[model samples]
Target: MIGEQGDGESVGTSAGNKRCRNKQQAGKDVAVQGTNDSSIVSKCSMASLGYFNDGFLKGFVNKTTRRAPLINRGYYVRAKAVDYSLHCFLQKTASYSQRQILSLGAGFDSLYFRLKASGELENVIVYEVDFPDVVQRKATLIKNKQEFMELIGCMNEIKPAQMDNLYLCGLDYKLLGIDMTEIVDLDNLLMETGLNPACPTLLLSEVVLTYMRDASSSAVIHWAANRFSSAIFVVYEQIRPDDPFGQVMQQHFTHLNSTLHALTQFPGKEAQRKRFLSEGWEECHCIDMNEFYTGFIPEQEKRRIEMLEPFDEYEEWHLKCSHYLILSASKGDLKTCLSFHPPPDFHAIKLDTFDPLWICVSPCEIESENPLLRRFAHCSSLIAPNIVLISGGFGSRAGHHGRLRGATLMTKSGPVWKCSFVGNEGSIHLLTERMFHSMTSFCDSCCVIFGGRTSPLKPVTSVLLLKCEVGDGTISSISLSVKEIECIGTAPSPRWRHTATEVIYKGQRYLFIYGGRSPKEMVLNDWHFLNLEDYSWADIPVIGPTPESRHSHSACSWKGGVLIAGGLGATQIPLASVFHLRPTQSGFFWNRIEVTGSFIPRYSHTAHILDDKLFLLGGVTIYSDSIPEVTLIDLKTGQSLDYHINTNLVKWPVMLHNHSSVLLVKERQVLVVGGGGNCFSFGTHLNHQPVLLQLPEIK
Candidate 1:
């Protein structure tokens, strides 16, 4: 009698625990379903802008929100990649009499309507499976839309009121409410719903599987491999969960309660490929969105998309691409359906030497409040011996964030630095709020500011001449005044992301401006000689072929000439070519230098010429596994060497691109002023403190 009483209590306890677990799982499932809403809205935005031809996506979302250009481009690539995979599978198995497409966790996707409207589903059947609630709602949406109804062509409702979960059934389309993790029941239901075990099938999972528990997701993969005879399984999801951008991406999903389960184990493309191959798949192929866009998409198509909107956030776009990837695993006859094709620049160099040059980096300990230091893409000029002037960028102050309108001067004393804001104490506003502008210091008290933009659409044209005056009252701070200067002759077009170097032509000082993007032009290669003495554009005669047009390139005045380093080219790829505009008696000529070493193609970095060597600091590269390092190129010997940063000495994440760096010649240090980027859907990250990188001597 006591044993029976104990058994009854145990059963009650187990029942209560099961109910609690079910409640938690239900909450997580609801969060996962919410991702579909946001994703479909982004798809609607992309389609509305004519990024892709999908008239049916509009029917899914109630209201379309216009996404930023960066987000639009991101969705564009994703849709294109998924569409390409489906088309490839169709074409590869066209000879077969029947083919099937099973989309796991499909939520409000209009794939069937799109393919049907295009007459591409002649012998193809699409099966969409999702949660019972999501499937029921999708069924209601389809039944209500006349367009979807016509495309689907007389679908039968299977016990709709009773919520049997079969939802909708049509000739070529089937929408079922089935839990994919319950492989046994899911397999039986799919078979009962006319899923052929021997037919050529294509399984599609977009941003699904990752939200499930790790074992559950793995079981789904294994079940798919075992259930199909000739099939191709395509997955689109996130990878690289440890990097700064990847961490932010993971956190974004985690905040939504839709954690990505695959990223921890399969952190990259290769790891993902291996995961499928080990899960009873014949062959697997994987590539990040960067490679897919460059290698698979045509140039004409890319150009057409580029013209859809004004975009300048290339760093965020590339980072987003690198974090997400698509994989295709095939079994039986569809083994060759997905083959990896790397882009031309996807290969990495194998270093022969064991010893690598290392640079120690440490954050600067400022002696005063450093709110002004929280900015990126701002210009920094060493105007005085111990003072550096910083001006113009999108930043935050006193909890208000916007484009900075004032200047800040950093004065170095012994080992500590103090920052004082040079505000608009005068009557009128002197400095215009901008980013990616150039400020060249000609003397201790004076500097000239050139073109930049308030946004990608508004480019600044007026040239500003700034003069700094030191009062006898304080040695730690200086006051600045700005004056607009007009130049005679044909001035360069309004542009930003260009370089203005101080070059001397026949003992006369001139600011040589070269290569920037304008509101009208994507990139400009034309150069102009600005005579500082008369403030006039001087005409120089005779020149070789101009270097490829680029912006975000690094240029430094060297040997009365200007040295141009790596930059993003017209093809949206980073350029590794280095050019020198050697000044001649009559004019300047372009001289391409061949540096002998494995150099990574990069852009958005700062360059400095010191001791006949060019130091390229902190940039973005698509194919690199880690962030770029300090690259030293010998001007005389035509040799290049890379030095890795000792990140152990640093306290914070060092985002080098879009940051300013100053060469401290005497201290043998490089002061990285401000750098970070809008980490693609995560948030904007700005460097909290400036870092000083101690340089080492090159052999």
Candidate 2:
């Protein structure tokens, strides 16, 4: 019933077009006899059935009316597109003091009444034209319903209404009857009803043109184009008439004796655009329903409506949506009136919808005196609340090999980066040149640096302590001190690429070291701890199923334990598994975490705990060269989601692995320091500078 069209004044038909015209006319006659109204009027009722089913219209229409779910979705999409276009037209022309809306072949369309009730009809004139019979029935319905009359401010008012020819007029509203094929009479009626040519106008035609002969439809379009100085014409109709789905759709209307004459001529968006352009319109835009759903519809509202029905016909739905389209043509100042971006008031029309959560990262300005030298495998730790200490790593810089520097995080200076201290100017320096090391903040003033490799075959077990103080709005001074720890038991062997985390146990501070490659290049899964109170080392026995020996892994303190994720496993392949370690009275217990989502196996990445969630940033993966991905893992549920940084606004780092990341908790940003460049081969060396990545608020 919804897809059916009504019969219009007969035109000279060629032998080739006789079958279609006769079938359509016969279907209209059958529909009128069956329902006591024109097929087009019943089609409007079918649309109302869909609106009520999809929750777009509630209590405004009869509750007993019902339609199929697919039909409802189709009608809902039509309603949304029409409403959005009207609002966009109005907003674009808000500066114009006078505006008008003309609805061609409008039959039982509650748009005027709805807009009037919503107070959107203020200072605007609306006109609807249809056949004499259709207009008389609609006028009678409006006259009998006080609720409908009240919308146009005609309630309880004595007014002369002609039922034979069907002419009604109210404040800012008019309904008239005219045969669309007769352009002379249509033009005369519009002129008699005080149509103004200078006013901005919006013309709407939904599934109306296809019912008329080609010449008649073209004549109507030309008349409107010549009448309005500034105007936009919006039309929604079927497309792809020859395709499988479209063929079925044509058959449905044909069986109902409704002809789609215009569809055969303008069967697609390109043809529709061409129609407007040839008709003297300045500009035209045409998009199919699939594009409208994906690109124009608000994603938040799309998700909400998707949940309203049980839909499993995805392939069919896509095919069906692709067969329908909305076309707009504009002249004069109306070109800027149509914006796909949702306006601020768009949410007011959507019920039971929520805004989608979006995460984005943009670049921040850096104000350092000297650019950071290119490097990789470097380690960094927060020495103070707003100060970070960066130490030795592989680089192209000519130096004694070992280097230490301090980066002062700027607060009120507006996203600026500054180097506070470097080289011998700092109180302390590394004992030797090293890379692939670990640094962990011990307290508010001290940080501990652990094992690393001075060269491929050379690994050191030395532990250094850094004492720093914030002064003059910078890390003005740093004192490097060596810790002479007394060993009560066997200590861990010399290893590189290990993880060291500072944790609290029984109201006392301790440092935990786990899994890395030993000096022999063998991966080790041993565990050890150092008591900060006495600086004593002790071997900690591990229980339960032990994690695979790994190197270049990442770990962080969580809930008085340690959470380790991703590293080079057996055969030097990146691992995707996650493991948690909990302190036990006997030793430490290990548990493998079950995670869900498309987890990327990576190594040389960095991880930080924020708001009880583990955030994994920038790493080299097996599948990709260097990943600029930000992955959030829920510590409690093990649920994970991945988000990529918006590289359009900020230049992406050449490489993410072997980098240092420190979270600025107050600012909710991560400062990523030097790492590798594009090429992964050691023969081709390229190092990147530092970048500040802004994180969206989680809530």
Candidate 3:
């Protein structure tokens, strides 16, 4: 009798622990469902802006908030990728009398209504599976909309109260509400609901499986492969969890209590493809959205969408695409099925190979009294051997975030750096209240500042000359003066994200401003020469052929002229071509210099020319898993190679885009100051301290 009593108590304790685990899991499931609400709202925003023609997305979203242009472009690509997969599946099995589409974790998606309205569901059936609560809510929303009910041809068929797992039963559509983690019950439920095993099936899991436990998600993949005679599985999820962008993306989901489990194991495209092949699949193909956007989408369609909104967030857009991918796995007769094919002209630089070049990176030691360095899209120039001038960025000011109305001067004393804010109460405000401006120092005490924007629509057009005076090389005795420069001639358009390099023409100094964007124009290709002696637009032109129109490119003075490389081209693609403005007896002529290397194309980087070698630092690229590397190109040999930076010495995520960098020639080090951007929906990330990268000895 005592033994029986002990067994009863042990059973009670086991049941109590099981209930606690179940409750915790239920809460996580709710958080995962919340992601669908936000996703649909973004989709609705894209749809309303004519990115795509989806008439039924409005029924799913309660309030349609217009998202940023970056978010809209993100959703547009996602919708196109999924639609591409679905259309491919249907076209391949068109002769087959029956086919099925099963969307896993499909929460409030208007897939069925959209497909039905398009008359693409002639002999096709779509089955949606999700949590019971989400399915019920979706059903309620659908029933409340008369157009949805009419499209489904079941005005009174979906009885939400009577539904437990099967929320709706129609001639071609089925809505099932159940926990997919219960693999055994889910299989039984699908089989009992008239799912034909012989039919060609396509399973869709859009940012869904990553939310579940790895084992649970794998079981679903395994079950689908075994159950369907011929099938294709399409999955969309995040990758590259170790990079700065990936870290921010993972943290965003973690903060919402919905962690992405698969990223820890399958962190990239190759791992994701192998994941399905290891779990009872014959073949798999994977590509990131970056590849899809450049290779798969039609040019006309791309051009149409690119002009739908004013966009200057190319860094965020490309980074967002690189972090996510679409993968398709197949089994049985559908082993040849693929979502899309890579373009014949597509070629990616092999970034995983070892490069011989390396550099050491460390954070700069700044005094505690220095102003906060949390800013991006700012300008930094080497005003003196020990003084760095930083001005104009979108960052924190007076504990609030906006365009900075002040400039900071960083002076080096011994090995420590000290910074003080320049006055903002007077003429300095004109030079400090702008972002994406260009600053070129003409001498040790003077620099020319021109062309920036307070906002996308408010660009600063007036030119300003800043002069610095240093006394006894002390921080307390340094003073600065700013004056407006009135140039006589036709000036260039008001622009930002341009480069101003000092080039010598006939032993006369000139500030050559080239390639920027304006609020009215997305990209500008024209160039102008500001004669530094007279401060007027010089009209000495003998150009053979100009480079492509671009912005956010890197330029530096080389061989008495300007050498420009790597910028976002007119098509919004990063350019890999390099051009040198060779000074001639007649005037200046553009010369194309062919660079030989497996160089990944990038933009928004800083460049410097030293001893016949051009060093390009820290840019945004969509083709590689690594952060921006210092690309070294030999000007004489036309050879280039990427040098990796040892980021272990830095204490924070080294996001290099939209930042400024200055090369200390005497120290043989580059100071990377103030970088980072609004990382999609994750949040704004600004590097709080300046990082210094020591250059290695080059031959």
Model 3 ranges off by over 4 Å? 1-17, 155-163, 352-356, 369-371
Write one digit per residue (lDDT tens) for candidate 2, span 3-81.
3233343355455566665675555744423322332233344455433222213323334344444555666777788
Which pairs of residues collide in candidate 2?
A: 27-257, 367-417, 428-480
Show model 2 residue runs off by greater than 4 Å: 1-359, 396-414, 425-427, 477-489, 624-628, 677-688
Best by TM-score: 3
In TM-score terms, candidate 1 sits at 0.93
Which segments of model 1 are wrong by more than 4 Å?
1-24, 157-163, 344-357, 471-476, 649-652
- Candidate 1 C-alpha error for residue 631, in Å: 2.0
Report the C-alpha lDDT of model 3 over 596-664, residue by residue, as the tens digit. Answer: 876778899988877788888988886666765888889899988888777898777788789899988
Sorting all predicted structures by TM-score, with the top scorer first, yields 3, 1, 2
Instruction: In model 2, state the lDDT of residue 282.
Output: 82
lDDT of 3 at 563: 94
User: Total clashes, candidate 3?
Assistant: 0
Candidate 1 structure quality by residue, lDDT tens digits, 8-74 = 2334456666576667778989999998888899899999999999999888878889998888899
Best of the two (1, 3) by TM-score? 3
For each candidate, the alpha-carbon lDDT, in order, equals: 0.84, 0.66, 0.86
